[model samples]
Target: MVLEREILPYFQWLLGGEGLGLGALPQFGLVMLGLALLALIGSYLFAAARYGPLGGGDLVFQTVSSGFREMWEISPRRIWALARLAVKEAWRRRVVVALLVFFVILLFASWFLRTDHQDPAKLYISFVSTATTYLVLGIALLLSAFSLPSDFKTKTIYTVVTKPVRAGEIILGRIIGFSLVGTALLAVMALCSYVFVNRSLDHSHQVEEQSLRHDSLGGEVLGYQGRTTLDASHRHDVQLNNENNGQALGNHGHSHSITARGDGHVVSAAEGIMRARVPRWGKLKFKDRQGVEKELGVNVGNEWTYRSFIEGNTQGAAIWTFEEINESLDPAGEGLKIGLIVRVFRTHKGIIGEAIGGAFQVRNPETGVQSELTFFDAQDAKISEITIPRKLVGTDNSELDLFKDLASNGRLEIVVQCLQRGQYFGFAQPDCYLRLPEGSATWNYVKVYLSIWVQMVIVTSIGVAASAVLSGPVAMMLTVSFVVLGFFREFFVGVATGTEYGGGPVESLVRLITQMNVISPLEAGASTSLIKGVDAVLQSLMLSVAQVLPDFSAFSTANFAAFGFSVPTDRVLQDLTTCLAYVAGLAVIGYFLLRTREVAK
Candidate 1:
């Protein structure tokens, strides 16, 4: 799904040892060792060329050995003192200006943000998350990139370097101090954003039984109006089910599904405007057009290559096997709530927004009895839900308990198939799942913010490391360039691995010059061969570069929070580990650069 070729290179490298019980630490250690060896070899060659072979050996060894020893010789007192100095300098430089700017942006955001969107909660969360990320990153980059360079320009770095502080200590102190300030700023901004969103979205409408129009059966209400108004321009139209429990819709672009309270007449809307389902993920299998069972669906025409599609009107079907059925987990007891976000590709559109029909089937594994397929109209590119009842009558007119009779050894199998002749259903693993009860939105919000902080840590560390060797402007430029490159690291890897079209950078340039498309083969000639050769070299270099850069996309949890999904613990740990590894490598590089630099000179 999602073009594993593009994203999996990094994930595979990082998570490969997950099953080996080593985690990413072993892979990280190996990489660090390789870098260390490369640096040592480069140093040896340079020394040998500059000085007669053996003359610079002692110099190289001393530098390497001393740097290694000095890494552990850090004094907490000296580091703390430098940290305090760094904080004081940051204050003097008016770093608080960034925080003030953040507040101003947040205060004026309501004027620009559309609160009447269909999912205003998603919009608000996305806006706040994006805005906070950009602001925090900007502040981190500025403070970290300019601090040491500014000190060097004013010859103030000599005051600290002259003391008993190691070069490593200076780097560490600066990182910690700057990170502390950034973290504090982020925490404050996050809290304010949370409060702002809550206040803006806090709304309720009055529902009276007399205002509702009942159906002929008198069990359901058709069109019901709420008395209370919201947002100055909108009122709610409430719809009640047979038990007088259902949903209410607001004209200003929001709706709420309700549940029955103590009495059937007394109903209340579900808690929280932003809520997500905790899914009991099941293992997926497939049946091909030949009715042969397979592990996955056939890949359809998608340039991005993210999802697989099941052929409609064919024997092809996607089956999900679920185990460990715990009825206690579900308070409804009505059935299993299944949520789906299916993408439809219509070969022929009879009418616009015309839904393709699909069917869901439940089979009894022990008795070989199956229920008649329940038909549902499938809308493309939107979330839809269905309920599978705990009790159902089989084809033989025998009643089956879903948990006791149909399910074998706590396992239940569900089959999904498209019924339309030409329409197709495209989906990935996460497209469909069982909808469990919602978790705390506030906790999810905090998790996303934490992810942003991890990103800040990475940017700040790289900035400080660059500043150790380069001048102020150059260091800033370098750090910024690395950040931009990190954002597209996966793309670079794709090109390098030949997964992306046009081969690599050189081939891409040639294609652009020659007005050739990606699918078109390069003409056979000396020029084409030369271009291909150069691209191979470039791809090698790009691959090496990608290995060192952080996978910035992995640290992004905005989508998860905005879409109301809990950020998985495994994902969080993976990103944090990757960030720390990059920081460690940068720290070592900074130490070496600072140790060799003649600051006083």
Candidate 2:
């Protein structure tokens, strides 16, 4: 029952909102991809700062040096030479080699660290965008700090200062060269990731389309195992036939006890209950394959059983069972033998064993008058008996759960029979039948789509991102930490909200005992926003914080997908934009800062 708001409606908005047709463009995943690409580029620039001739100082020096040379109308060759010197000098540093080696190792390792997941679109896009930013940023910082410090130590600035080349050119050129190289590497990685993601998305789209080819219908099906129980007040209708001398029984809502004596006819206390049964030897109508009508002959027989009463010393009452007889008998003779059979199985009174020996008629409770069906033969056994509800009969052996074209097949033909008293019998019970038709139920797609992707993207993005910024040792440490954190963000958040120290005793204990803990510091980060107000500020900060490591919360859309909800494309775009903007922005700013700072020579 989770609504769109629960998973952040990005997909909902992108898929053309609720109930809208699929958009021409797959907006949400695309938007996220765009932002991820942007971030990838930003991270690349930051990484490239190491291998080039210029350093951070080159920006200021390049502007001044270039401006002066322009005024003097110096040759373009001289300007090019100066730029080349800056790049060559920077590349000669051991720090540049070390940084490039580190980046290349990470980039290559990423290729082998494949996930077993079937869907790779979100996972691939998320990993590349996040991992590149973090790696490039760290490399940029290391190169900037290491190379600049060496330049100072070796007094290299003094030599460069004597030349026409300005300090800014040295710094800015270093930044540009490193940026160019790193960005190129990242662009390749991003392209590969994009291809992987699109393949996954395309596969997902095909699956959905394939499923829509057929329709599903649902309805109530009575899975009667032997028998079905009904409430005491339950009632059913019985059809009457004039040719069979059929009379609907149990019509007046009166309860009756039927007893079969050593007699040919059944006696009933309530005339209404006794009259409902149709004579077994009667003409029945059914349809043949060519839509033609046919008649079935039913024969009734009387067998004796007893209704045993447990309340008053286990009294026995007579009951009868009717069996159908089939023979080539004349139509006129059928009337003399045709009659209904009533069998009683359950009763409020007690239990039954055999047929009664002598009783033939019974006094009605309503009229206080006697009603009779036959004479007592005295030779039938005097068996124990109990009054019970009458039984209905049907073949009920269909292979399928639902009946096909039930109405068109015509009404079902069967006799109502129950074992009452000591004899096998039939009572005026309602006829049994069934019908099957097409029907529908509602399904939700928003939640289904949202739950799946939300968790996937959120977990993979944050996990890889955290791995990027840390040292080889620290990266592994952060990877494990972020993986757990990503999986249990809400649980950790709740702990943070309720704990005295805002995180938990675990965090507090760790702080007191050691510098390290299982929960990530980045867990406290917020998500970003697209709006433009105080709310937007809060949202932006939240989004930025959420991306601090790699929030995989968005990929939890699997649950929604299971529920058959459609995800909108826009929401994915928003998330991607927010994440990419933050990461890339951070990387770019880090790059700019790195370009200004001097690196060790």
Candidate 3:
């Protein structure tokens, strides 16, 4: 329900842009600039009306222009001085008290969070990440919003304003100072949370040779009943290959894969399960029922609309084209490791937990040679790994070298399809990728925190900007409102565009008044037309607002860390750019707002 109410709308907007071949960034920028200009004009008009001609438009322009120039020429010393004062002010307001609350939560979390269920590691990671995010964000908002307003209330602002200080400098000081505080808080919390999770789930079990029995054919020692020695808390049942070595494997909740050492036995812990994976993303292509190459498949009955599903028992197929293949990249020498997260949508439940059958095939474009279809049983909502061997022997017992024969100019195609009738396989662009080993899990963990820091910066900047024109409590409320609304911007867009079940706000109100069902068409009448007209107007306004607000959910990287996936460099860069753009815009708005304020008066 939250996905539909919040996440679905933003994704729907993205899909709409993709379908229409429109660039989202340019459109977003234009809308944002337009809104900014409108706000500037509205502020100018209000100032003119309140302060009369001399103190109105002319005074506002003078103040803004002078403040802008002064801001540009402001010395680092002034900014730092104000920053230090802000830090002291935050301490005066007892912001560190929030950190104490965070500590208490971390200490008591073990009692409430059930680790006996599936994927305790994932649950722990999710809990810590969510807790730290909310706690840090709240503290940042409070500091940014109240610092300046508190100064105004105590007449301390007058002392700063009357000096050689510009309003923009004050804003910059608040943002930088509060950000430092937030950074410190977040750093401590992240470290503590990580340590807490690691210590809490620090479990290990010893495997003995007596517990393992040798298989006749493979000559490999297999653990008893596919399980190993049980510890007091938990036990690992690691699978071994023909060489009697444990293979790398993962479950939904793990932050990394677990592997056994020589002799098919090793001590395993939560920390041992984590290892960094580097993914080689490939370009995806789809073939329609008519076998024509297409960009993507048609959407199934999914409300999220993020992934497209190919019909089962049909000619439709999703193909991934991988390039730059070499033996060096495949360190294991066993084959190429492809990680896939496929969503299975079953039309009928044959049996609960019964995996559906899927097929993966490797084909050569130039030689028309293809490998045997690799059949794998895929569970719904789980990631499956399939390894493609370097050599594919044909039915005639002829060996086809994967890199030498199948690869066309070092390019290979892997096709995915659903083998079962009435069962669909859903995939997005990010669902499947080649797992290229990279940095450790600890390094990737740091990157996730960096993404959260970017979000905190944005919130702090907005809070400071709001305080430029609003009272302390009002500014805090406004900042909090922005966060809540930004998180659900897509939901507002859906309502405005009649994409939600109840249609636009006005139409929903009308339906409520007339006791009409949401799905049914309205009866033909003057009232219906009037209601529709009002709805159209309201939708247009809401749409304009939605276009300007940043989608806060886009900054979250908790899922990536929780699922043992590396946060891509491109994603981190994109988030940083987005944060900077918003901060710049808000800084400009704050400058103009603070310039017109009568701080000295």
For this target, which candidate reaches the highest lDDT against the unseen true structure? Answer: 1
lDDT of 3 at 223: 32
lDDT of 3 by residue, 1-601 (tens): 0111222233333333545554445665776679767876886788779988667887668765786687679778888998888888878888889889999998899989876656676678789988988888898888888877888889888888888887778888888888888888899988998899778776665555565555554663443324545543455555555455552233324322235566555644545344456667677778776668888786776666777788778887888888887677677778888888788888888566678888888877667677777889876666676778888874355787777777857778888988777888887776777877657788778888888899899999999999998999999999998889888887877898888887778778877988988999888899778888888999998887777577877677777677667776766766776777778778777877787577796
Tell me the whole-model lDDT of each prediction, alpha carbons only: 0.76, 0.34, 0.75
Clashes (candidate 1): 0
Q: What local lDDT does model 2 show for residue 136?
A: 45
lDDT of 2 by residue, 482-505 (tens): 555656665545444442232343
Ranking by lDDT: 1, 3, 2
Model 1 Cα displacement at 253 (Å)? 8.7
lDDT of 1 by residue, 424-530 (tens): 88877667777787667788888889999999999999999999988878988988888888888878789989998778898898789878898889889998899
RMSD, candidate 3, Å: 4.8
TM-score of 1: 0.87
What TM-score, computed on C-alpha atoms, does each candidate reach?
Answer: 0.87, 0.25, 0.86
**All candidates: CA RMSD (Å):** 4.2, 28.5, 4.8
